[model samples]
Target: MILETSVVPRDSAEPCADRLVLGEHVLGVADGATKKPWDTGPDGAELAEAVAGHLAATAAGCPAREAVDGATALVRGLLGDAGVGSAVSFCVLHLGRREIWRVGEGRVLLDGLPVPPRPSGERIVAEARALVLRRHLADDVPEATLRADDPGRAAVQELLRALVGLRNRPDPRYGYGALDGQDVPDLFVEVVPVPGGVREVVITTDGYPEPAPTLAEAERLLAQRLARDPLMLDPPETKGKRPAANSFDDRAYLRVAL
Candidate 1:
């Protein structure tokens, strides 16, 4: 039984980059990345929708890993060179074997504990922001105006790009993986086994601040957190925009049970 499933967008104007697919025996969730406004190609939401749809269409007969590979290939084919190179975090729940396969940042929670530890990129991103912030401070730029619209935004973005590129190499310590419109050799795939008697499992994107036993509780907690720290600036990790911008990333939550 599925207790509850939902995909919520951050704002009305922006497309919801998150997707949820429920097949006869397979369930999936995908979280799309946020692309820059200047990027004219397919956005993260489009990539996520296509990927999730392909996975659901073939999941009944295909193996989980194969389904993901196939979906990636199909999406690449469809986009071709015109692809914007956006990526998504995908999670699939196989009911037949009580197993889950997660790629990128989508999370699997069993009994309220994360199956695999969160990515180390969070700390890296925070550190990178601190470094960028220091550079901007030397230029006498205010922290509030450090978004894409600001004049100094380009320089800041350049610094972030260089730092992130250096850190995003294919290595255990820094290889942050995602389904970015390219072949990734160091894909982070986690296979988790469900507990013997556990009745339900929750898979979600990183939008939720933490895992909760129930989807409602998780949403409530996430909302509270967002209200208190909309920009996530307290610890800030490559998020937040100028005032009047969407405060949170796209969110998806799914609960499947026996």
Candidate 2:
């Protein structure tokens, strides 16, 4: 199930935030931008869509980590083709009937405890930047380039650092940088299998808490509503509270049971 609402001011190319839920798994993607000029391009949103499409199709059969890896690859491919640069954040959940993995920063509500926040700073900036740069060289990488070690992943890390220095400058056509200066967030998550019972899995973007104090508060608020009215999971009131469109920030959240 996929539920999304775009806060208008649609004169720009950017869409609010978008989300996708497949089976017992959920995914959210948010695009961040700097306030300087306002280049609301389609790059971040497009990469997120690709991530959703790949995850929705392959997650059911593949390991959650593998699913995330493939989806990340897909995003890299899309951004490279467009010669676009932007930040990305994602969440992946499996029913816990099986193993699951989550990487990158975002909110994760397991049982009830909110995991301690992941490191979010220049590290995120380096990671998101590298993920985009890797796409350009993926095809040329030798299958044996790093048999014992994945050079591709390593290369991405290094390149990300180099790209971060190339700060956003004013362009008559493109505007300010999509990712101002704050680093993107990332998470690496996996749910340990419980014997057998119904379970609720929630994943959300950082935007949901931009105004709130912390992710724990947002998750608790959303979870309380879900416990009482599962249908309230997707409500128009939710959209109204989301960041205004053209802010170049997008967010998504999902809930699932197994």
Candidate 3:
């Protein structure tokens, strides 16, 4: 298996705050969103890379689950008080199989197949803090349950819709409930199998698409590129999100070839 990373910063001088690591059995990336328009910096990505690198170093020496748990804890510790957090997305490729743990809105393309949705309640609450503020309601808060009608699912979908709709319209006096004025990150994890006959896997942040691209399209494109020129699979300057003054968010990605 092989791992490659590519990022497009919001500005020329801003360092890409995206990070990734490729373990013998796992590979992943973390993208930190910058709230300030012209500010380019690293937030949780650094912590994520550190933890992922540690997992990679010990993958063969330990159980994959244990390694992943350890890495997660390490990253959590690193971001404890940095005032920097992230939307976490990770994929582990195990013995001819892959599984993903996803927190936020990142994408995972497996053998060209899209990762299935995993409900995230805490993450929804976190976003509410960022968007709604004093207007955020208790009913709006996400409940920690996996099934539908779950408070978390409802809160997240509503909050996200409001965010997308309100992004283009700025109003300083926005109101939300409980978590009125605070910052929070989107997070998730993804896993992929790297058994023989597998082609490729792609992971990317939400900023790359208006409405996220279909899994089939991503798979077809990646497969075709690999067949025509494998080297292009890991190009020096890969296609990334183009920067704009009013861009919704930053974009980042990781590509694994097997």
| Top candidate when judged by TM-score against the true structure | 1
lDDT of 2 by residue, 1-258 (tens): 332222222124545434453544434333332211222344455555555566656544566545545554555455453224554445555542344344444555544445433443334434443443344336665323322233333444443444333323322222222222222222233333433542544566644442223345554664454344321112211111122222212445554444
Q: Per-residue CA lDDT of candidate 3, range 51-126, in tens?
A: 4566456544455445545655565465553223332334344423444534345567666666654433323334
Q: Show where candidate 2 strays beyond 4 Å.
A: 1-14, 23-42, 81-84, 96-100, 122-198, 210-249
User: How far in Å is the alpha carbon of 14 misplaced in model 2?
Assistant: 4.3
Off by over 4 Å in 1: 37-40, 82-84, 117-122, 130-156, 159-169
User: Residue 250 of candidate 3: its Cα lDDT?
Assistant: 46
lDDT of all the models against the reference? 0.67, 0.41, 0.42
List residue ranges in candidate 3 displaced over 4 A: 1-5, 33-42, 61-64, 80-87, 95-104, 119-197, 210-247
Please give the TM-score that candidate 2 achieves against the real structure.
0.48
The superposed Cα distance between candidate 1 and the true structure at residue 81, in angstroms, equals: 3.2
For model 1, how does the per-residue alpha-carbon lDDT over 88-174 read when each residue is reduced to its tens digit?
A: 678878887677877777767776667764364545565556566667657887656655343333434654454334332466765
Backbone clash pairs for candidate 2 read 33-178, 102-188, 102-189, 103-187, 103-188, 104-186, 104-187, 105-185, 105-186, 105-187
Q: Each model's RMSD to truth, in Å?
A: 3.7, 16.9, 14.1
Given candidate 3, what's the lDDT at residue 13? Answer: 54
